[model samples]
Target: MRARALVPGVPALLPSYASLDDPVAPLRAACLSAVGELGPRVRVVASGPSGRRVGAALAEAVGAVVVDADETGTLVVGNGSATRTEKAPGHLDERAAGFDAALRASFDHIDLALADELWADVTCLVGLPPLADGDVRYDDAPYGVQYWVAVWG
Candidate 1:
């Protein structure tokens, strides 16, 4: 691939979900910058419809077109863990930290069952290279959701 990017599939990143204060400003900026680096034609890899929509939105915002073939870039949408805190969507799974840490190490071997329990969106990450192989722009569990904005070439 000429260019590749990884971003969380958070609905907050969408323009339609914009709030007055913008809770995800930094993440949005990072996503936009990574997406902007992608060429005009991008192929989006996402686990579900929401994730797909988020990828499409980011690509569109950067003036990139979502394509099925002849892609100049690839946008992969997924995240680590969602049960990082008590208020997390998955409600504080004690195993979240370890699971996310292992995931950060490599995406080559993921336990789908455990991932599901922790609310991790990693299905689209199956064939992609490790995140450590790229430039990680953001890595945090803001609002209890583990998010990473990374890029590869």
Candidate 2:
């Protein structure tokens, strides 16, 4: 399964996405112009601890789906290694587990740094999804563990 998220730093956003299967690339590329940024890569918690990595950790983990990344925005997740699970601006009670692979952040072991310039306004993404049962994804059937890391615009 594949998920795509849109942390659109702009108003007229397009289809932002995070995917697991190979079919997600085209959909992601198609919305680049409209969204102004590309998606970053994260990992699935269910995939394992070592695989749960990502870029733009600060923004990816907390920022809203449509918040501005400029001015009051925080680029703490900037192209750095220590920011694998950086928290966003308004996060007050984030836990170690919550920041690393919580939600859908852990999916594909992300290495996409901000400097990579995959896209313009987009941030990070992963191939994992958090199960509704409050557990990490373990199945590789596309919908299992890759749900949290990816979402759609």
Candidate 3:
């Protein structure tokens, strides 16, 4: 079995929350492109209902199906710290950058407590396979929030 993608649970990705200017245009495009790579049937792993909704919307946009059982591809929705800078959602935590860096290196042995403190949505990332250099499709801190879109086979 192979995991298809790792996308952020940013509400802006959804059409319902879209703005007139579309602040996350590039990120949204990258996510749709990555999600489109997964074959029709996909399993979604998300942190909560909102995350699941984002995954479902993406799947719907790409003509993919979200399956509950027996799936070859999995779509995991989550993100790094929301406090990368002063304008970040969690508002500037000095430790946010370093915390996100460690997560980017390896999802193994994460300090859950610290993750919560930093406002990282890593609930679904805990069990994912280690990320490799070439697997990353996007890695940037837009809106002062660390977001990544990666694929793993």
lDDT of 3: 0.88
* Candidate 3 residue pairs that clash: none
* lDDT score at residue 141, model 1, on the 0-100 scale: 92
Summarize candidate 1's per-residue lDDT along 1-153 as a digit string, tens digits: 589999999999888899999999999999999988889999999989999999999999999999998999999999998999999998999999999998888888899999999999999877677878998888999889899989998
> What is the lDDT of every predicted structure here?
0.92, 0.26, 0.88
Q: TM-score for each prediction?
A: 0.97, 0.17, 0.95
Rank ordering of all candidates by lDDT, starting from the highest? 1, 3, 2
Q: Clashing residue pairs, candidate 1?
A: none
Error of 3 at 136 (Å): 0.9
Model 3 lowest lDDT segment of ten: 127-136
| Candidate 3 lDDT tens digits, 1-153 | 565699998888888998999999998888988888887888899989999999988888889999998776789999999999998988999999999999988888989999999999998899677677437888999898899998876
- Model 1 stretches astray by more than 4 angstroms: none
Q: Show the lowest summed lDDT stretch of 10 residues, model 2.
A: 73-82
For model 3, the stretches where C-alpha displacement exceeds 4 angstroms are none
